[model samples]
Target: MEYLSNWAKNIVYYILFVKLISHLIPSGNMSKYIKLFTGVILIIVVMEPILSLPNMEQKIKSNILNMENIIAHKDFQSQSKTYSKVNDQLAINLYKKQVEEHIRKLVRGEDVEVSSINIKINEEEGKNFGEVVSIDMKVRKKNSSNDLSIEKIKIGADSTAYNITAEDIIIVKNIKIALRGFYNISPDNMNISVSQ
Candidate 1:
């Protein structure tokens, strides 16, 4: 728009200059030549603005390209943030599933049916195994012979299912000793429960 206004101003200036020169020239063939020369100058004045367009276009194009680059960078950053959140959630879910699987293996080859496993994790600490806050397990047996339910309740005995009893426990001097270990927390910080 500025270029257009400048072009108009240049045209007005050239017209005034040509008019002033016309008055100074004498009436003869030389005057005709002067008039013709002024006409050529008028043509040059009209075309000057149009000829300088490529340089102006280059600057405008450069600004447009810069804006596009900025928009692309911002879009990438937004996508990365979204993906990071999704990835974190997926990691937590996968870890929980793995823990459930490990508990199932603890039952070994038996008739016990695991109902559900609920574990509450600390989101602030991320999905690290040490960040586990609590775990609740529900399980039952199909039959007495294929189960260790009654043995688990026996007054002074460790029970077995499928001839299996895997542990490091010792009940001596009326002080029941069990080795229950977990990461990222002290013994007092962990909460665990199992029910049949």
Candidate 2:
């Protein structure tokens, strides 16, 4: 009786193994082809949007009037009184957003067209503001069909908050003009110093 029971157990185990293996295998040619098609579709669906993101050919147009303050002045610590005079919360936010938008636009395009900008700060005021929160830069532009000369212009950028200070202004504007067909950005030329 024990031998008979053992034989029955072995048969049952073999039947289960066969059932499991059959279930794991693809049932028909149609099912296998369907899986291949689904995999291809999934790959295309996932890659399309990522590949279609805005390209670098997009132009980043920066309106000098809109970004005059933020782009003109450098961000740094400033005395309280001086900070109040130059710091425009609304302008700051607006320019900041515009900067980001402009970058996006440029990434989608090729070159950035800068018009003009100006900045001024009262060093005597905002004493409590500590170091300057921003510095001033002056920008100018001329209307023409040809590419602008960025090498002839100057640019100054300083981030006192991050301990980055730039005193020498370079002619990046000319280089930007040379790369007219490429993605380029030339803000302005400026440096931090005592107001005369």
Candidate 3:
């Protein structure tokens, strides 16, 4: 790999140098120099990756084929629609589990029983395309002993599936602090204080 990378670097340097000299020697210096330099830089930028891609692609293809063979040998197969449905459910479940764990840690209580947790997949009215799946959750937690309302928490977890498995198929992309309040809880929507 090192040898190949060195070889590619040297070839690119030589090509750019030759192009630079050829441009400097001809066509009145200034305009040609600018055009040739820009062109040479763009070519190097694009072609360097192209030149280095074959080795990486070969490794990826080999690994994928090996994985496929292993799965086939293990007699594992699912229809495309079924696989997608399973994946979506897995993603939602993963988000719920994470939220439960996080709330348990954050809230000061022993019997930290979480009430209903809802997850919604919002892909509309935004520019979140081909990136992370944004998940909105409405959660309720009780201070088990006193039974006091730990004001209904509204949070969001962002995730994307990568290496999906048979059982737990979703992978976490990122989870951020979205909103914290009791506004999501009441019939009349009374105000509540949110502390950091």
**Candidate 1 stretches greater than 4 Å from native:** 1-20, 27-51, 107-111, 125-130, 146-180, 183-196
What is the C-alpha RMSD, rounded to one decimal, of candidate 2?
28.4
Top-TM-score structure, candidate number: 1
Clashing pairs in 1: none
Whole-model lDDT, candidate 1? 0.60
What does candidate 2's lDDT look like per residue over 62-171, in tens digits?
A: 34444666645534334555676556655555654564344334322222233332323223435532222332332222333764333321235444333221211222
lDDT of each: 0.60, 0.40, 0.46
Q: For candidate 1, give the lDDT of residue 76.
A: 93
> Deviation in angstroms for 63 in model 3?
1.9
Candidate 3 per-residue C-alpha lDDT over 1-196 given as tens digits, one digit per residue, 9 for 90 to 100: 8866776777777777767766666656476676677678767765775677898799899999999998876664456667877887777667556754554353323222333333333333356422223223332323234533333333344354233222111111111221123112222221111111
TM-score of each: 0.54, 0.18, 0.25
Q: Which lDDT value does model 2 have at 97?
A: 51
Best by lDDT: 1
Q: Model 1, range 52-154, lDDT digits (tens) per residue?
A: 8899799989999999999999999999999998998899888878866765565433435567767666777545643656655455544444433332333
lDDT accuracy of residue 90 in candidate 2:
52
RMSD of 3: 26.8
Clashes of each: 0, 38, 0
